[model samples]
Target: MLPSIGMALVLLFSMSGCGEEDRRGVLFKGVVAPPGIVMVAGGREHTLALMADGTVWGRGSNFYGELGDGTTLNSLTLVQTVGLGDVATIAAGGLFSMAVKKDGTVWAWGYNGFGALGDGTTTDRWSPVQLQGLSDVTTVSISGYHTLALTHAGTIWAWGYNARGQLGDGTIEDRLTPVPVAGLTNVVAVSASTSGQYSLALKSDGSVWAWGSNSSGELGDGTWLERSTPAPVQGLTDIVSIAAARRHGMALKRDGTLWAWGANYYGQLGNGTRTSTRAPVKVQEPSGVISLMGGEDHSVALKLDGTVWTWGVNDQGQLGAGRDDIDSVIPLKVLRLTEVSAISAAWTHAMAMKQDGTVWAWGLNNRGQLGDGTTTNRNIPAEFLGL
Candidate 1:
């Protein structure tokens, strides 16, 4: 049996601890995008920012040296990552980080228990090390412990943890080196869930494909069976972008419509219901959305008006709902947050870049992941001072 879920879901609890208290994140303020940052990303307990000058800055938990600064000391302020320049893209996994240089070379550091560093070994790195046989890479994505890289040639290669087949390599075995993904081409983008055992890819034709754990129907395949190979997400077309979390998948269509499927234990699916679904359901609110981001068990939307909104679990203000320890099954505006050029949502905190180039952050500050020179969690957005 599927077991009883609230409303239209099942399963008593997420095997990955998707309970009432597990969801949380930091917030940011000040319309915050500091002058040169082109992008931001977060791991389980750290953050990284890429600048227009092709350099990287980071703060928060550096345990396992995810900050790539050759140390594990957490930072309450942004610190430059050592020995990297001309970086074109950056990504963070649970406790590791990776970057793609302008020349299309990939480099990684931090937690290597599952060989997420892609150096063909299970050893931690305090500094960035280039991966072998991976070049001309255009971008990369990281989930809990696995990673996916998209090359300039429009092909996908992946490595690291694959307990749930998130690698799309037609096997469940973990990899210490990059393996070409099967049956996918002209791929424009890919996303690996924060901690879920699944991955998603968007092709140039506006179709989406998914693989790995299907528990709670996260794969959107109208079934609960897990897959080691890629499968098309049914009924989705014209998808411009996609995002994934621990147990759900979100998509934004060309028409600005937002849709989601999978676990709704905390209403992370954002369909005005607490029930999970095996098929796509329209997000009740948030129209004119230009982008979508998925936290551990929450959802974030960036609108055409440069405004931001969030919903689902607020245990640590991951929803930025203006108060802590609350959960909203429907969309709620992130109070007074606007003119945001971009946003990065993660397991315990979030960062936003404003039109002015100042970065702001909020949510769980444990380990100083908020990078506001404090370890206090914010129920609302807070400006990160002193850059």
Candidate 2:
């Protein structure tokens, strides 16, 4: 039986009553993109920008023309994603990109080394190509070497690296096309860490499932064993959302609490220490968290009160607090910044959109991913321009 979802009606242009409309299609249980931005927090070598009109802009690390800018030439400037409009969300892998259109179609570009493009070919594309054989895609998630999609019909599909069964097809052979993730049904959303070697699934009933590499207990099943198929993350239920990083995972409980597990070498787990955990542990934060993003070495959370909190590695100033000395093991407030409505993190930098439609960025700027008109790193959040 399909899980029952409570519905609330929300007006798109109005902040109040947003929950009403937000829950409209919850019953269908399709792919759920990471809140706000689509790029993996620290896995994306490029930056993805979403315009007000639903167009997308991408720049940086186009090693394979992953930017979908029609050129392999690396871009330090924003290049509008060609041939796409009415996009609802966008994501980038190591050298590939994906976007879910407003009409539920998925588009991809860049390297197809392992068939990550899901276009039924190994040919790399310098321009956007619509994914073959599926529609009603609600969310698209990309990792360093793979891709995953969730459809409105409550099914999941994956492509790319399968060396460790990361593709979850019970095989170690890589695929050059999309393949169904066996045994999963009524799935609401799917997430892949930057590595594309493990995954998490959120079902319609608010339960979480995991597969792929579990050497570090990232699967959250209480045992560090690799799973070739979906397995429930022990004791985890009623999850509203989930996200993954290189070796860490995080989820927001239905009641607005945040929990994390797996790698914490840089304190990405938000437990006030660098110790690794094998199971979900509550993140130490003072406010109720509405959403969470797990970066390669840091984590960000959007609070119910419109404030943003960050923790983990500050080596590249990814924490956006104007100093690299404070490696926040616990959620600390970002100063001089407020009214943030959405946040996205790239390989090293982070972008936050304000309630007024302005964007702000901070952290590593070596590749000009920060879009602040320069390549120099900024330790504090700075306004972004060029739309």
Candidate 3:
């Protein structure tokens, strides 16, 4: 169903006026982006890519360096995250690695424990530091150890591991730097969760908001009680796209449908049912989805015809589906992939990008994160030519 997709970080603040220049050089609001391999991120096994000439590339587990390349030593080849170049967007957490350059400023590298590398302290970087209070910052999100930033002024900034409040700011304590998530304003888009607790936002009026630890309901807002602030995710609205994982959360509606809510055990809310639900609920067969990712248990979509649909936990295959013991509550079909533009998933592994940029990966390649040098665990898709 991939109907000509592209555009995954979706935050749009207008401004493209002076011609073109944002291949990660997002400056203030132009967001231009259209060149090659715009985004891909994953952490827990490590993998990253940002190129449109902005530079930033990585491979599997660099222990704590999370492959920012300063040397925590864990490679499968593909390197180059050192001094950084334009780097418009790239994020991966739970082990750390973040970038948001192109001048908006924000950088980080590998696991800073509860500090999530906000850079104020907890110290764990091996390279790429810059995060000092954040700057123009257009986009950033990191699940499972906290991190969220979105700033062309629409507001939102948070820092590492906030227990269950996931840094929403009303307080679960634990931030090591940047803070401001209380009232939330224009908030174009944001998503955080992978075990780091919870979060979700997207408001240009499309409405969808949520805040930390709903135990298993994942803050879809039907109520499991746990929000340090934020709140509105009930039936959803125009919702262009959203995804969160630590339990579950998925949104996408401007007619293309797809909805989800809270922990489905291992079903990851594809809607075929593993029970858990707190509010929304629609995802079943694949749809025109466009793009979405949220993997701790699983959920990935990309349709309109580019073909790539996944469902919950395929154990180690992460549902590429050709094998790996089975676990789909609904959406499947990921084998040979297709046009796929971009996609990313964490923990169990999944990565994709190929509008000629190549790169494909499958679940749990142990520490090699499927760069193809192999730690072996693919239920399907494999091509990953280095970066």
Candidate 4:
């Protein structure tokens, strides 16, 4: 869920009267951050942070203008995403960035090869642009080449690549503009696989619905057939949250139990086995989970105790278990981290936000996504300065 719209507006107005010099302190908003990160989003090779002041910042790869700084140059240090303020929440896709403003309008920028920007075009944007035909939007989710918007009225709108029907419009046709998702209503939250071939929605009744590429069982319907429309996941109820990865899916029950299905070649299922399944399987250890995230081939869980655990492929130290060349079939506690408030995982890197509002990252840093001011990878968690 996203932060309240009212609070975001309050913060934005409170800092609206600052002087020019004070505004110059922060590159994008022109106002210095209030020393805390309220939210974070991870992309394939970049990351975004939303400050307590309702401003957004980006770092790492900007090859496709994913950084949203009006340039394609990547930065190791944080650069404010120009023209974004009063943002309620932010999401990062494979090579794009999205934000929901306090006014309930959605904005997007970056790679739009398949019209992921939803602005009726396929041109990449170097800075934020108001997404056409969308308003009263509560949240936005982006994947490899598509996006989803959930409006306050409980309607879900989709656009972009639909080769595998990830758009959920009951068709395999790509859309350059927002299209209503067929037959889905009362959706409280939605998620799209970072790989862009599948999607999931959690309804008000706590039932999970899936669509798109079911190959590798990503749809969790006990079938490998692809879906052009929404279908109920087998045997899942009381689910509070859902996450989709490259070829897998995960759900967090209200009781803090984590369930995984789909691809398990690398044990992303976290069920103490490397075998894949078409049905949901219980994840091992640290049951009091409050949130969960999945990467290309790994998974992460944030327990109520504020500790983080990770499993699956660690070839790039994405698991943050002090090793980078091995895989863990079961969950392992991340080294030297605690008091975590939120977590995000991309294809090969992961990030955690401590209660103090400081962000930490580890794993692949070839594009400097780690934000530690270096391209060197860390086998253990490292503090990311500049909030």
lDDT of each: 0.82, 0.75, 0.79, 0.87
lDDT digits (tens) for residues 1-387 of candidate 2: 111111111123223454422432232234221223322222355677766567777656565767776755555566666788888878877667888898888999887877888888888898899987778888888887778899989998888877767778777778777788889899988988766779888999988888889877788888888877788887788998898777888888988888888888888888888888878988887457777776667888888777778888888788888797568888877766788777776655677777876678888776566777677787788876555
Measured by lDDT, the strongest candidate is 4
Tens digit of per-residue lDDT, candidate 1, span 1-387:
111111111113232554311221122122232346688887777788888888887777666778887765556667667899999999987878999999999999988877788999989898899999999899998886889999988899999888888898899999999998889999999999987489999999999999999988999999998998899998999999999988999999999999999999998888888999988899988899998988889888999898888888888887777898888888898876889988889886777778887767777877666767777888778876655
TM-score-wise, the better of 1 and 2 is 1
TM-score of each: 0.90, 0.86, 0.35, 0.91
RMSD of 3: 16.2
Q: Global CA lDDT of candidate 4, please?
A: 0.87
Per-residue lDDT, model 1, residue 178, is: 96
Q: After superposition, how far is residue 222 of candidate 3 from its true place, in Å?
A: 12
- For residues 1-387, could you state the per-residue lDDT of candidate 3 as single tens digits? 111111111122235452222322332233222346777788877787787898887776765677776766666556678799988888887677888887899988877877877787887887889977579989888865778899998999998777678788898888889899999899899988777788898999899898988978888888899988888999799998898876888998988878998888778788887999889899887777777888888988888788889898787888887887678888888989888877788767888887888878888876666878878888898987644
Report the Cα RMSD per candidate.
8.6, 12.6, 16.2, 8.0
- In what order do the candidates fall by lDDT, top score first? 4, 1, 3, 2
Candidate 4: tens digits of C-alpha lDDT, residues 106-147: 989988887889999999999999987689999998988889
Better candidate number, 1 or 4, judged by TM-score: 4
lDDT of model 2 at position 352: 77
Q: Cα lDDT for residue 106, model 3?
A: 92
**Could you say which candidate leads in TM-score?**
4
